[model samples]
Target chain A: GAGVSQSPRYKVAKRGQDVALRCDPISGHVSLFWYQQALGQGPEFLTYFQNEAQLDKSGLPSDRFFAERPEGSVSTLKIQRTQQEDSAVYLCASSLGDGSSTDTQYFGPGTRLTVL
Target chain B: DQQVKQNSPSLSVQEGRISILNCDYTNSMFDYFLWYKKYPAEGPTFLISISSIKDKNEDGRFTVFLNKSAKHLSLHIVPSQPGDSAVYFCAASRNQFYFGTGTSLTVIP
Candidate 1:
Protein backbone atom coordinates (compact mmCIF):
# COMPACT_ATOMS: atom_id res chain seq x y z
CA GLY A 1 0.00 0.00 0.00
CA ALA A 2 1.15 3.53 -0.64
CA GLY A 3 2.40 5.37 2.42
CA VAL A 4 1.78 8.94 3.39
CA SER A 5 3.28 11.43 0.93
CA GLN A 6 3.98 15.14 0.75
CA SER A 7 4.32 17.37 -2.30
CA PRO A 8 6.93 19.98 -3.28
CA ARG A 9 9.85 18.19 -1.65
CA TYR A 10 11.60 21.53 -1.39
CA LYS A 11 10.30 25.06 -1.18
CA VAL A 12 12.21 28.33 -0.90
CA ALA A 13 10.39 31.46 0.13
CA LYS A 14 11.36 34.98 1.09
CA ARG A 15 10.63 36.36 4.53
CA GLY A 16 7.09 37.65 4.90
CA GLN A 17 5.92 35.48 2.02
CA ASP A 18 3.38 32.70 2.36
CA VAL A 19 3.62 29.05 1.39
CA ALA A 20 1.32 26.06 1.35
CA LEU A 21 2.47 22.47 1.81
CA ARG A 22 0.33 19.51 0.91
CA CYS A 23 -0.02 16.02 2.36
CA ASP A 24 -1.73 12.89 1.09
CA PRO A 25 -2.39 10.30 3.73
CA ILE A 26 -2.77 6.64 3.05
CA SER A 27 -6.16 5.55 1.84
CA GLY A 28 -8.63 5.00 4.70
CA HIS A 29 -6.42 6.72 7.24
CA VAL A 30 -8.57 8.64 9.70
CA SER A 31 -5.94 10.68 11.51
CA LEU A 32 -3.41 13.22 10.25
CA PHE A 33 -0.77 15.29 11.95
CA TRP A 34 1.78 17.95 11.06
CA TYR A 35 5.17 18.59 12.57
CA GLN A 36 8.15 20.91 12.18
CA GLN A 37 11.73 19.74 12.41
CA ALA A 38 14.73 22.03 12.58
CA LEU A 39 18.17 20.87 11.44
CA GLY A 40 19.56 18.20 13.77
CA GLN A 41 16.46 18.45 15.94
CA GLY A 42 13.54 16.15 16.46
CA PRO A 43 10.15 16.98 14.99
CA GLU A 44 7.82 19.22 16.97
CA PHE A 45 4.09 18.77 16.89
CA LEU A 46 2.08 21.29 14.84
CA THR A 47 -1.56 20.28 14.64
CA TYR A 48 -3.81 17.26 14.34
CA PHE A 49 -6.94 16.43 12.41
CA GLN A 50 -9.41 13.60 12.68
CA ASN A 51 -11.38 13.14 9.52
CA GLU A 52 -12.38 16.75 8.62
CA ALA A 53 -12.29 18.29 12.09
CA GLN A 54 -9.18 20.09 13.34
CA LEU A 55 -8.91 18.74 16.86
CA ASP A 56 -5.68 20.04 18.31
CA LYS A 57 -4.10 23.27 17.19
CA SER A 58 -2.27 24.01 20.41
CA GLY A 59 1.04 22.89 18.97
CA LEU A 60 0.84 25.46 16.20
CA PRO A 61 3.47 28.10 16.85
CA SER A 62 1.34 31.11 16.10
CA ASP A 63 -1.66 32.44 14.24
CA ARG A 64 0.35 32.64 11.06
CA PHE A 65 0.24 28.87 10.79
CA PHE A 66 -3.01 27.35 9.60
CA ALA A 67 -4.14 23.93 8.42
CA GLU A 68 -7.24 22.41 6.85
CA ARG A 69 -8.62 19.04 5.84
CA PRO A 70 -12.06 19.83 4.58
CA GLU A 71 -12.81 16.63 2.70
CA GLY A 72 -11.08 14.23 5.10
CA SER A 73 -8.55 12.95 2.65
CA VAL A 74 -5.83 15.46 1.77
CA SER A 75 -4.53 18.21 4.03
CA THR A 76 -2.64 21.46 3.62
CA LEU A 77 -0.50 23.37 6.04
CA LYS A 78 -0.30 27.03 5.18
CA ILE A 79 2.14 29.50 6.60
CA GLN A 80 1.33 33.17 6.26
CA ARG A 81 4.08 35.79 6.33
CA THR A 82 6.80 33.22 6.80
CA GLN A 83 9.86 34.18 8.81
CA GLN A 84 13.46 33.11 8.59
CA GLU A 85 12.98 31.39 11.90
CA ASP A 86 10.33 29.23 10.29
CA SER A 87 12.91 27.55 8.08
CA ALA A 88 12.71 23.85 8.71
CA VAL A 89 11.43 20.55 7.40
CA TYR A 90 7.68 20.15 7.59
CA LEU A 91 6.51 16.60 8.19
CA CYS A 92 3.12 14.93 7.89
CA ALA A 93 1.93 11.66 9.37
CA SER A 94 -1.19 9.56 9.35
CA SER A 95 -2.52 6.72 11.37
CA LEU A 96 -5.21 4.09 11.01
CA GLY A 97 -7.19 5.31 13.99
CA ASP A 98 -7.87 8.69 15.55
CA GLY A 99 -5.43 8.45 18.45
CA SER A 100 -7.88 6.12 20.12
CA SER A 101 -5.85 3.10 19.17
CA THR A 102 -2.13 2.55 19.52
CA ASP A 103 -1.72 2.34 15.77
CA THR A 104 1.70 3.54 14.70
CA GLN A 105 1.90 6.67 12.62
CA TYR A 106 3.21 6.51 9.08
CA PHE A 107 5.23 9.57 8.10
CA GLY A 108 5.78 11.27 4.78
CA PRO A 109 9.08 12.30 3.19
CA GLY A 110 8.46 15.88 4.27
CA THR A 111 8.81 19.31 2.67
CA ARG A 112 11.96 21.27 3.38
CA LEU A 113 11.03 24.94 3.73
CA THR A 114 13.78 27.52 3.46
CA VAL A 115 12.91 31.05 4.41
CA LEU A 116 15.37 33.70 3.33
CA ASP B 1 11.69 21.26 28.23
CA GLN B 2 12.07 17.97 26.44
CA GLN B 3 9.76 15.29 27.73
CA VAL B 4 11.63 12.49 26.01
CA LYS B 5 15.42 12.48 25.65
CA GLN B 6 18.05 10.47 23.84
CA ASN B 7 21.08 11.56 25.79
CA SER B 8 23.59 9.93 23.47
CA PRO B 9 24.01 11.91 20.31
CA SER B 10 25.55 8.95 18.48
CA LEU B 11 26.57 5.33 18.86
CA SER B 12 28.99 3.03 17.08
CA VAL B 13 28.77 -0.76 17.00
CA GLN B 14 30.60 -3.46 15.09
CA GLU B 15 28.52 -5.44 12.67
CA GLY B 16 27.13 -8.75 14.01
CA ARG B 17 27.37 -7.39 17.56
CA ILE B 18 24.60 -6.12 19.78
CA SER B 19 23.71 -2.44 19.66
CA ILE B 20 21.82 -0.75 22.43
CA LEU B 21 20.11 2.65 22.30
CA ASN B 22 18.73 4.29 25.40
CA CYS B 23 16.06 6.92 26.06
CA ASP B 24 14.56 8.63 29.08
CA TYR B 25 11.53 10.72 29.75
CA THR B 26 10.61 13.15 32.48
CA ASN B 27 6.87 12.81 32.21
CA SER B 28 5.54 9.82 34.07
CA MET B 29 2.19 10.20 32.41
CA PHE B 30 3.56 8.88 29.14
CA ASP B 31 2.01 5.44 28.77
CA TYR B 32 3.15 4.62 25.27
CA PHE B 33 6.72 4.65 23.92
CA LEU B 34 7.91 4.13 20.37
CA TRP B 35 11.16 3.92 18.46
CA TYR B 36 11.70 5.12 14.92
CA LYS B 37 14.55 4.88 12.43
CA LYS B 38 15.29 7.47 9.79
CA TYR B 39 17.68 7.81 6.89
CA PRO B 40 18.84 10.88 5.08
CA ALA B 41 16.10 12.58 3.04
CA GLU B 42 13.53 10.20 4.50
CA GLY B 43 10.84 10.25 7.11
CA PRO B 44 11.08 8.48 10.44
CA THR B 45 9.74 4.93 10.25
CA PHE B 46 8.24 3.11 13.14
CA LEU B 47 10.57 0.45 14.52
CA ILE B 48 9.11 -0.89 17.74
CA SER B 49 6.94 0.23 20.62
CA ILE B 50 5.93 -0.81 24.13
CA SER B 51 3.14 0.17 26.40
CA SER B 52 3.84 1.18 29.99
CA ILE B 53 2.18 -1.94 31.26
CA LYS B 54 4.61 -4.14 29.36
CA ASP B 55 8.28 -4.21 30.15
CA LYS B 56 9.46 -5.58 26.85
CA ASN B 57 8.42 -6.26 23.28
CA GLU B 58 10.30 -7.92 20.44
CA ASP B 59 10.08 -8.00 16.69
CA GLY B 60 12.45 -9.98 14.52
CA ARG B 61 15.95 -8.76 15.41
CA PHE B 62 14.71 -5.78 17.39
CA THR B 63 13.64 -5.63 21.03
CA VAL B 64 12.37 -2.75 23.14
CA PHE B 65 12.59 -2.72 26.93
CA LEU B 66 10.86 -0.23 29.12
CA ASN B 67 11.40 0.56 32.79
CA LYS B 68 8.40 2.45 34.00
CA SER B 69 9.83 3.26 37.41
CA ALA B 70 12.99 4.77 35.99
CA LYS B 71 11.14 6.43 33.13
CA HIS B 72 13.67 4.83 30.81
CA LEU B 73 13.58 2.66 27.72
CA SER B 74 16.08 0.95 25.45
CA LEU B 75 16.14 -0.65 22.03
CA HIS B 76 18.42 -3.59 21.39
CA ILE B 77 19.39 -4.80 17.95
CA VAL B 78 21.16 -8.11 17.89
CA PRO B 79 23.56 -9.00 15.12
CA SER B 80 23.61 -5.41 14.01
CA GLN B 81 23.65 -4.89 10.28
CA PRO B 82 25.27 -2.06 8.37
CA GLY B 83 21.87 -1.16 7.02
CA ASP B 84 20.86 -0.24 10.56
CA SER B 85 23.10 2.78 10.41
CA ALA B 86 20.81 5.78 10.69
CA VAL B 87 19.20 8.17 13.13
CA TYR B 88 16.98 6.52 15.75
CA PHE B 89 14.37 8.54 17.55
CA CYS B 90 12.63 7.69 20.80
CA ALA B 91 9.14 8.98 21.39
CA ALA B 92 6.57 8.95 24.18
CA SER B 93 2.95 9.88 24.36
CA ARG B 94 0.25 10.33 26.93
CA ASN B 95 -2.38 12.13 24.90
CA GLN B 96 0.12 13.78 22.55
CA PHE B 97 3.36 12.31 21.28
CA TYR B 98 6.83 13.79 21.81
CA PHE B 99 10.07 12.69 20.17
CA GLY B 100 13.65 12.84 21.35
CA THR B 101 16.40 14.66 19.49
CA GLY B 102 17.49 11.26 18.07
CA THR B 103 20.70 9.25 18.10
CA SER B 104 22.73 8.58 14.98
CA LEU B 105 23.96 5.00 14.97
CA THR B 106 26.86 3.85 12.83
CA VAL B 107 27.13 0.10 12.36
CA ILE B 108 30.66 -0.79 11.32
CA PRO B 109 31.19 -3.73 9.03
Candidate 2:
Protein backbone atom coordinates (compact mmCIF):
# COMPACT_ATOMS: atom_id res chain seq x y z
CA GLY A 1 0.00 0.00 0.00
CA ALA A 2 1.19 3.47 -0.74
CA GLY A 3 1.85 5.71 2.26
CA VAL A 4 1.21 9.40 2.50
CA SER A 5 3.72 11.36 0.44
CA GLN A 6 4.71 15.03 0.13
CA SER A 7 6.20 16.68 -2.92
CA PRO A 8 9.41 18.65 -3.44
CA ARG A 9 11.20 17.07 -0.47
CA TYR A 10 12.77 20.52 -0.05
CA LYS A 11 11.76 24.03 -1.02
CA VAL A 12 13.49 27.40 -0.69
CA ALA A 13 11.60 30.64 -1.09
CA LYS A 14 12.33 34.33 -0.79
CA ARG A 15 10.89 36.14 2.21
CA GLY A 16 8.16 37.76 0.19
CA GLN A 17 7.48 34.89 -2.18
CA ASP A 18 4.59 32.47 -2.04
CA VAL A 19 5.02 28.74 -1.80
CA ALA A 20 2.75 25.74 -1.94
CA LEU A 21 3.45 22.29 -0.52
CA ARG A 22 1.55 19.25 -1.71
CA CYS A 23 0.49 16.07 0.02
CA ASP A 24 -0.91 12.83 -1.36
CA PRO A 25 -2.80 10.80 1.18
CA ILE A 26 -3.42 7.12 1.05
CA SER A 27 -5.98 5.86 -1.43
CA GLY A 28 -8.86 5.59 1.02
CA HIS A 29 -7.85 7.78 3.90
CA VAL A 30 -10.68 9.78 5.39
CA SER A 31 -8.84 12.15 7.69
CA LEU A 32 -5.89 14.35 6.75
CA PHE A 33 -3.79 16.75 8.77
CA TRP A 34 -0.93 19.18 8.34
CA TYR A 35 1.65 20.14 10.91
CA GLN A 36 4.68 22.41 11.06
CA GLN A 37 7.81 21.43 12.94
CA ALA A 38 10.47 23.94 13.84
CA LEU A 39 14.05 22.96 14.57
CA GLY A 40 14.51 21.54 18.04
CA GLN A 41 10.76 21.72 18.64
CA GLY A 42 7.72 19.52 18.42
CA PRO A 43 5.32 19.42 15.54
CA GLU A 44 2.50 21.97 15.84
CA PHE A 45 -0.90 21.44 14.31
CA LEU A 46 -1.80 23.54 11.32
CA THR A 47 -5.10 22.39 9.82
CA TYR A 48 -7.28 19.34 9.35
CA PHE A 49 -9.60 17.92 6.75
CA GLN A 50 -12.30 15.35 6.91
CA ASN A 51 -12.76 14.40 3.27
CA GLU A 52 -12.32 17.71 1.48
CA ALA A 53 -14.02 19.69 4.23
CA GLN A 54 -11.70 21.76 6.37
CA LEU A 55 -12.43 21.01 9.99
CA ASP A 56 -10.03 22.32 12.63
CA LYS A 57 -7.54 24.97 11.62
CA SER A 58 -6.84 26.51 14.99
CA GLY A 59 -3.17 25.58 14.81
CA LEU A 60 -2.33 27.60 11.74
CA PRO A 61 0.18 30.27 12.77
CA SER A 62 -1.32 33.12 10.80
CA ASP A 63 -3.42 34.31 7.90
CA ARG A 64 -0.57 33.55 5.59
CA PHE A 65 -1.29 29.88 5.86
CA PHE A 66 -4.02 28.09 3.95
CA ALA A 67 -4.82 24.45 3.18
CA GLU A 68 -7.21 22.66 0.87
CA ARG A 69 -8.10 19.04 0.21
CA PRO A 70 -10.29 19.36 -2.84
CA GLU A 71 -10.62 15.73 -3.91
CA GLY A 72 -10.29 14.46 -0.37
CA SER A 73 -7.19 12.52 -1.36
CA VAL A 74 -4.57 15.18 -2.11
CA SER A 75 -4.02 18.40 -0.17
CA THR A 76 -2.02 21.55 -0.51
CA LEU A 77 -0.70 24.01 2.07
CA LYS A 78 -0.08 27.46 0.71
CA ILE A 79 1.83 30.22 2.40
CA GLN A 80 1.74 33.80 1.17
CA ARG A 81 4.60 36.19 1.75
CA THR A 82 6.91 33.67 3.33
CA GLN A 83 8.67 34.76 6.48
CA GLN A 84 11.96 33.66 7.92
CA GLU A 85 9.98 32.11 10.75
CA ASP A 86 8.20 29.87 8.27
CA SER A 87 11.34 27.90 7.67
CA ALA A 88 10.59 24.40 8.90
CA VAL A 89 9.36 20.99 7.84
CA TYR A 90 5.75 20.72 6.73
CA LEU A 91 4.33 17.32 7.59
CA CYS A 92 1.14 15.69 6.38
CA ALA A 93 -0.61 12.67 7.82
CA SER A 94 -3.62 10.56 6.95
CA SER A 95 -5.69 8.02 8.78
CA LEU A 96 -8.15 5.34 7.77
CA GLY A 97 -11.13 6.81 9.61
CA ASP A 98 -12.62 10.19 10.35
CA GLY A 99 -10.55 10.25 13.54
CA SER A 100 -13.04 8.39 15.75
CA SER A 101 -11.30 5.11 15.20
CA THR A 102 -8.01 3.95 16.72
CA ASP A 103 -6.43 3.76 13.29
CA THR A 104 -2.90 5.08 13.47
CA GLN A 105 -1.93 7.98 11.30
CA TYR A 106 0.56 7.40 8.49
CA PHE A 107 2.89 10.35 8.04
CA GLY A 108 4.56 11.56 4.89
CA PRO A 109 8.28 12.13 4.55
CA GLY A 110 7.62 15.90 4.79
CA THR A 111 8.78 18.84 2.72
CA ARG A 112 11.39 21.08 4.25
CA LEU A 113 10.59 24.67 3.37
CA THR A 114 13.18 27.35 3.93
CA VAL A 115 12.48 31.03 3.64
CA LEU A 116 15.51 33.12 2.79
CA ASP B 1 1.73 27.02 26.08
CA GLN B 2 2.96 23.47 25.47
CA GLN B 3 0.03 21.19 26.10
CA VAL B 4 2.11 18.01 25.77
CA LYS B 5 5.63 17.90 27.19
CA GLN B 6 8.53 15.46 27.24
CA ASN B 7 10.77 16.93 29.93
CA SER B 8 13.73 14.71 29.11
CA PRO B 9 15.54 15.79 26.02
CA SER B 10 17.58 12.60 25.76
CA LEU B 11 18.24 9.26 27.44
CA SER B 12 20.86 6.52 27.14
CA VAL B 13 20.25 2.90 28.04
CA GLN B 14 22.13 -0.35 27.61
CA GLU B 15 20.78 -2.93 25.21
CA GLY B 16 18.68 -5.72 26.71
CA ARG B 17 17.64 -3.31 29.47
CA ILE B 18 14.35 -1.63 30.24
CA SER B 19 13.89 1.80 28.69
CA ILE B 20 11.18 4.17 29.81
CA LEU B 21 10.18 7.49 28.27
CA ASN B 22 7.71 9.77 29.99
CA CYS B 23 5.22 12.40 28.87
CA ASP B 24 2.84 14.84 30.58
CA TYR B 25 -0.04 16.89 29.34
CA THR B 26 -1.94 19.88 30.67
CA ASN B 27 -5.14 19.13 28.78
CA SER B 28 -7.70 16.74 30.24
CA MET B 29 -9.79 16.52 27.10
CA PHE B 30 -7.25 14.35 25.38
CA ASP B 31 -8.85 10.96 24.96
CA TYR B 32 -6.23 9.19 22.90
CA PHE B 33 -2.46 8.95 23.20
CA LEU B 34 0.17 7.76 20.74
CA TRP B 35 3.91 7.22 20.49
CA TYR B 36 5.93 7.82 17.36
CA LYS B 37 9.52 7.06 16.42
CA LYS B 38 11.62 8.89 13.88
CA TYR B 39 15.08 8.73 12.36
CA PRO B 40 16.86 11.60 10.70
CA ALA B 41 15.52 12.66 7.28
CA GLU B 42 12.29 10.78 7.80
CA GLY B 43 8.75 11.17 9.04
CA PRO B 44 7.57 9.76 12.33
CA THR B 45 6.27 6.18 12.40
CA PHE B 46 3.56 5.14 14.82
CA LEU B 47 4.75 2.73 17.46
CA ILE B 48 1.83 2.17 19.84
CA SER B 49 -1.25 3.86 21.23
CA ILE B 50 -3.58 3.81 24.24
CA SER B 51 -7.03 5.20 24.75
CA SER B 52 -8.25 6.96 27.88
CA ILE B 53 -10.30 3.91 28.84
CA LYS B 54 -7.31 1.61 29.03
CA ASP B 55 -4.69 1.94 31.75
CA LYS B 56 -2.18 -0.13 29.86
CA ASN B 57 -1.68 -1.73 26.49
CA GLU B 58 1.15 -3.89 25.27
CA ASP B 59 2.45 -4.93 21.87
CA GLY B 60 5.42 -7.26 21.72
CA ARG B 61 8.15 -5.44 23.72
CA PHE B 62 6.47 -2.06 23.44
CA THR B 63 3.99 -1.04 26.11
CA VAL B 64 2.07 2.17 26.68
CA PHE B 65 0.72 3.29 30.04
CA LEU B 66 -1.80 6.00 30.65
CA ASN B 67 -2.75 7.73 33.89
CA LYS B 68 -5.78 9.97 33.51
CA SER B 69 -5.76 11.39 37.00
CA ALA B 70 -2.11 12.27 36.94
CA LYS B 71 -2.28 13.64 33.41
CA HIS B 72 0.77 11.55 32.63
CA LEU B 73 1.74 8.93 30.04
CA SER B 74 4.74 6.71 29.47
CA LEU B 75 6.14 4.14 27.05
CA HIS B 76 8.23 1.23 28.23
CA ILE B 77 10.34 -0.97 26.04
CA VAL B 78 11.57 -4.21 27.56
CA PRO B 79 14.96 -5.51 26.58
CA SER B 80 15.43 -2.50 24.44
CA GLN B 81 17.46 -3.13 21.31
CA PRO B 82 20.07 -1.05 19.56
CA GLY B 83 17.73 -0.66 16.60
CA ASP B 84 15.34 1.15 18.91
CA SER B 85 17.59 4.19 19.05
CA ALA B 86 15.73 7.17 17.70
CA VAL B 87 13.60 10.17 18.64
CA TYR B 88 10.32 9.33 20.37
CA PHE B 89 7.40 11.71 20.34
CA CYS B 90 4.39 11.78 22.63
CA ALA B 91 1.08 12.84 21.17
CA ALA B 92 -2.43 13.33 22.50
CA SER B 93 -5.53 13.98 20.54
CA ARG B 94 -9.30 14.19 20.50
CA ASN B 95 -10.28 16.43 17.60
CA GLN B 96 -6.79 17.79 17.00
CA PHE B 97 -3.33 16.55 17.95
CA TYR B 98 -0.78 17.94 20.38
CA PHE B 99 2.76 16.56 20.33
CA GLY B 100 5.66 16.68 22.77
CA THR B 101 9.11 18.00 21.95
CA GLY B 102 10.40 14.40 21.68
CA THR B 103 13.00 12.37 23.57
CA SER B 104 16.14 11.10 21.93
CA LEU B 105 16.86 7.55 23.06
CA THR B 106 20.21 5.89 22.54
CA VAL B 107 20.52 2.18 23.12
CA ILE B 108 24.13 1.11 23.53
CA PRO B 109 25.02 -2.45 22.66
Please compute DockQ, using alpha carbons, for every candidate against the native two-chain complex. Answer: 0.72, 0.71
Tens digit of lDDT per residue, candidate 1, span A1-116?
69999999999999999999999999999999999999988999999999999999999999999999999999999999999999999999999897643778999999999999
- The true-versus-predicted C-alpha distance at residue B54 of model 1, in Å, is 0.8
Expressed between 0 and 1, the share of native interface contacts present in candidate 2 is 0.64
TM-score of chain B of 1: 0.98
Shift of residue A93 alpha carbon in model 1, Å? 0.3
| TM-score quality measure for candidate 1 | 0.98
lDDT tens digits, residues A1-116, model 2? 58889998999999999999999999999999899999988888899899999988998999999999998889999999999999999999999987653767889999999999
Summing lDDT over every window of 10 consecutive residues in candidate 1 chain A, give the lowest-scoring window: A96-105
Each candidate: how many clashes?
0, 0
lDDT of 1 by residue, B22-102 (tens): 999999988899999999999999999999999999999999999998999999999899999999999998777899999
User: How do the residues B1-109 of candidate 2 rate in per-residue lDDT, one tens digit apiece?
Assistant: 9999999999999999999999999999998999999999889999999999999999999999999999999999998999999999999987778899999999999
Give every collision pair in model 2.
none
Clashing pairs in 1: none
